[model samples]
Target: MHLRKVYTIARHEYTVTVRRPGFIVLTATVPVLGLVVAVLVLVAGRGLLAQVDTLVGAMEKPIGVVDKSGYFSPVLPAFADDFQRYEDETEVYRAVDEGRLQAAIVIPPDYVQTGRVYVYSPQNVFQRVSLEDSHRLRAFLAVHLSRPWVPEEVLVRLSEPLVTLTPVASRQETAGPWASFTQVLVPYMVAILLVISVFASSGYLIQGLAEEKENRLVEIIISSVTPMEWFVGKVVGLGAAGLTQMGIWMLTSLALSGGAMLALVAVSPIPWYRWGLFLLYYALGYALYAVLQAGLGALGTSTRETQQIAGLASVVAFVPFMLSGLVFTVPDAPLVRGLSYFPLTAPTMMIFRLAVFSVPTVDVVVSLTLLVVSIPVAGWIGAKLFRLGILFYGKRPSLAEIWYALRSA
Candidate 1:
């Protein structure tokens, strides 16, 4: 293998990518939009969160009172400072209907004397407060009142468990609700981006290789360089061009956020490390596909057939991409975990699963090692095919032709 010729092939591939307006745009577009969206999301999310906190605090304020059994009439004020006093439920209803009060309570006319209690809200007349809300109010009233009102033990009983939320373990804790939503979404978008990228890079490597063959330039390169050098060069060269496009995007995002938002996001220790995980998968996936794509490219006479073949693999590789949202609800399911190790589906599926579920560290290590091992093994097969396919172009060689090419190589 001639190192110089390999570098030459690598350089040639790089130049071709740099000169393509389409490739340049595809690589840069998403990161730019992500940065813009990131800023908007941060600002809007903060406003929404801040607004939610304030509203939750306000919603807790007493808008009306309930006096079941007439026992609460004298002690109600101790529990409800802002709750409007009323002679009857009708007055409370009038206050609610006229917008004078946000909510009301009914004492069942025997609440003070009996165990029965009833409350009212315009929002949901029959709806009971959630356990958390009920517990908090009970705790608050229990502390403020002089008389025994809304018995703490009774309130605790009234408030059922609000949610039976069980968490799925992942190495990274989801950055709260909004942050988790953001983390899951980022990968889906990136999957599409990388899918496009795998094709653009590998597809070009093929087109360039095919061009050299058709022009008899490949024969000349083969004279000075081993097929391996030519193949490796083209892959590295084109891959770099792709990375350059990604680099520009990285820079653009840092600039847009003035680095602070990125810093804030990164400090969260969740989504911040996704880029590292994403890159690890990207390299593995790219390596595996690059050889197959190159082999196919060498066999095709026209660019159209080459693209179609490459596109099919991309579509197949992207199949796991659709499962991203589903994993959020069932990340630890056997089906989802199985897909993470399946080569075609692994990159996108496994990464999202890793992000959502607390995948065993052993599992991640094993899966990654498996994918890494597959890369060169895949390349070897593709190289044999590429060696034979380069000279056998036109009308897409039949399965027989591909078979013969492999044997001869």
Candidate 2:
């Protein structure tokens, strides 16, 4: 491989792709869109919480009570301003209808024997009572009634404890809810971003190859440089462009939501070592896919056919993403462990495992070893296909022909 020629070709590819309108629009708009989405979600959440608070607060208004049994009248004074005793049910209904009271309570004459009480309110207003409101009301009544018998300390002890216990098997304690959520979400996001970046960048390689072949430019270009050199140049160039795009996205995200992004990273359970491993896997995975895409592109005579082939390959790459939920729940499951060893699925599955669970060191070593070994094998096959097919036009080569080319190249 000629380094100068490869660099020249790579530089040319990078220049062409980076200047494209699509690249500019995508890079610029993604951050803005993310900001908009985040703001909208925040506003919506606050609005919902505020509404719930309002509902609960509204439930605390004075309720008119008609006590024929006369037992609750003595205890009613404890509620003070929140309680209003009425002699008859008509007066209670009148107060509720006129909006002077939120609701009316009726205590039957036999309430001391049978502890049944009835509540009355407009159907529309009554339906707004939330579970929280019910719980608060029950607690208030329980406290007042039990004040005469049960001790306050006993009541406090009987209520559910506010403390939470987190078990730790090793030196590291189990992750909190936010940390767990971050762990799962970040891995899936990284996997999706990796897949998208690979597909998007590799598409440029495929389209460039197919376009060169269609325009009869490959014939002239291949005369000066070896096919392998040309292929390496394209991969390096496009891969750099992909990384640049992702870097821009990361920077933009930080610029737009620095505090939130920092908090998320701070709370995440992923260690620095796992992040380094992720980068390694990302590079290897991109190289593997890039070469394969190049080979497929060389075989196709038109942009449409090349894209269809690339799309199918992208689908295969995304299989690990589809299994991400399973990885989050059971990182050590047999199927998940198996996928982590497969070259196409290894990068994403390994990321998920490292992010959410403690993967055995041996498994990590073996997964990386398999990927490292597979990259070159894939490169060799891709080079063979590219060298043979770059010159051929019109008809796509069959698998048998490809095999023959692989052997003969």
Candidate 3:
């Protein structure tokens, strides 16, 4: 319980972990690989874009338009090459059959009233028309319909709308599509990174625990330091190491992308406060799992066995991800909300919900409270398990015995 003893133990654990060759290699590998990939992309990006443009151009056969209504007489000069006028629907079909046309568009005579356009394209059974093809036909229709009413510049802007959103409060401008996409993407990325880092650091904890127990070193360590001090020290020190790894990976990405990552964060549609919540959830999630791992890890007789036992916690953590499709589609559904409040799944589920839509303030508060409250209870249970299991040898303890021990602790 002494602050000095806890700090000394924590310092020792952190120094030992960060200095390990495995830790150094694992930490550096990602950034080094990212740098190599970034360099290659920068060197060849222009050439790659050019090649893609050429390939697309070569593959895109001109679309045939049958203007039965005679409304689209002189095709717009802008779309002249992309669209070829065909007088006969039969001729258009023939051209399409011969692979000379990518698609055939038939304009009905009642196009003014019904506005029904027939499209013919070859595709597999499950396939739909390509977006580019549909977009081109729609653009052609829109231009002809609206050109007579709106100014030319206005009509052009209708298709290529480069909109920016500026909220009254933040006064930050965000690009339309990119910002929306980032709102959904960033939360998912944070959740995944949080889980990975927590497990990686906790894996170190369990591995060290199992090694010490196996070698009969726990007795010596415990004789010098109280169990609570040892447990708290390991958790704090390893959590710092995990935080350090996550920081390095993020910095590497920012450096590799030439500050593009920073720009994305600035324009992200996620509220500023949600980012803070993400950090809070990450810390609580890591602490809760670390406590669980410390207990379960001590129960195992070997490092591999310890990891296997500790991995059950990871399985529980990943349940939210497995049901992520539902979370994304129905963020406010009963099941998703329940998961969001459940301590084990709360961190990831809440993050997933936040990415998809705005979760209610009450739900956020409740979930955070649950995670905050669960850590101490888990710590007490873990302390009991660690205290008993660290010294006990031979057969693995049964659930009944563990329950009894918990009651006694």
Candidate 4:
């Protein structure tokens, strides 16, 4: 209960945790790995585009054509080395089968009247053909088919339409595809970050508690300070350490990709206020989980058992993330809305809804209120467990004993 005691404990916990090699590795490695992955993806994407260009260029090999329409044969010479005119469809088919041609284009008798042109390849390879090839073919046809009767402007317009239609919206609505995409993506990222921070920090609290209890260190520590002071100090101290880890990762990410994050914010349609709310919800969510983990850690006598309990809690915490796809698609759905009010799932779901849609103010208010209210209640229960079970060694206290402890003064 004393502020001085709490600060001392918190400082001790934070220092010990931050100095650990695991903490340093995790904090530093996540950002580096993220940067590496992003760079690889960028390089791979460029490589893929280059490969496609090469493939399209390679596709300029000779193509056999059966011009049943009689209109294409005269103009086929204009295509030069790219196309070879064949009198018989059988000859074209034979040429394709002999691997002398990459593909054959068949112009039906009704080609001038009907715009249908059939392209045949030996192995249905064109089914997986790229858009560049299709565009090239269209350009070739458009040039050859243009006549004195049809204006060049008309031909060009027909080949490539310049008209683009975009929906008009007020300043409040997300205006473009990029904005809408970021609206969904940012919330999902924040949700994942929240889960990671909670798990990382709370797991530390659990392990520390289990280890201290195992070593009989809590008995001596408790002798100097009340159990309540020790419990609060450990939670506050460990929570700060967890926050420090999160801060490092965030700073590293920003340092590595500040431009990308800035670009996202520039294009995003969601207001900045929503992000502020996200931070508040994240804190509440962390406190709730941290306290619950602390209580569960108190119940266990070993690191392994505490971890199992923490794992179960983690699974429960991740339910919202599992359902995030559904949340993205239908943020206002009855089931999603219901889960948004649930203390375990609320943090992620609320953020998701706020990002994707114009969530009702009442909904946000109610969810926030519930999460905030649950934190202290969870802390009280966890504190009772910590007080009762901190001294118990080897065997874990039963549910009945935990309940009895809570019921006791």
- Which candidate comes out best when scored by lDDT? 3
Residues 1-409, candidate 2: write the lDDT tens digits.
8899999999998898889897888777878798898888798889888977865655667777787765555443336576678888888898887777877878788865776677887645454354226644455345545655776576554342344767665524756668768877877777777888887776677767776788888779988999899888887887788778888888888787856877887788788888898889888888888877877767776888877776666677788778877877887889999999988889888888888788999889999999999988888887888887787888788889988998885
For model 1, state the Cα shift of residue 271 in Å.
Answer: 11
Query: In candidate 2, which residue ranges exceed 4 Å CA deviation?
Result: 32-129, 132-154, 170-177
Error of 3 at 66 (Å): 12
lDDT, candidate 1, 1-409, per-residue tens? 6788788889988998788787767766877688778878898889898967855664665556555443445544334555555777787877777766656656475533453445565554223555226654454334333235657555444343354454566543444545556566666655665776686676666567667767777677677778788778887887777667756766776687688546544544345456787778877887777766776666667667667766666676777767766677888778777777777677877667655556777667767888888877767766766677665646556788778766775
- Model 2 lDDT-worst window of ten: 123-132
Compare candidates 2 and 4 on lDDT and give the better one: 4
Segments of candidate 3 deviating more than 4 angstroms: 43-46, 53-73, 76-134, 137-175
If both were scored by TM-score, which would come out higher, candidate 1 or candidate 3?
3
TM-score of each: 0.65, 0.79, 0.76, 0.76
Off by over 4 Å in 4: 32-128, 131-174
lDDT of 3 by residue, 228-338 (tens): 888888777777777788789888888888898788878787777878888888878988998888877888888888889888987788898899888888788899999
**lDDT by residue for model 4 over 137-169, one digit each (tens)?**
676577556644677566556555546555566
- The full ranking of all candidates by lDDT, starting with the best, is 3, 4, 2, 1
Q: What is the Cα-based lDDT of residue 103 in candidate 1?
A: 65
Worst 10 residues of 4 by lDDT: 123-132
What lDDT does model 1 reach?
0.66
Stretches off by above 4 angstroms in model 1 are: 27-153, 156-196, 199-203, 206-224, 257-278, 322-338, 358-366
**Per-prediction backbone clash count:** 12, 0, 0, 0
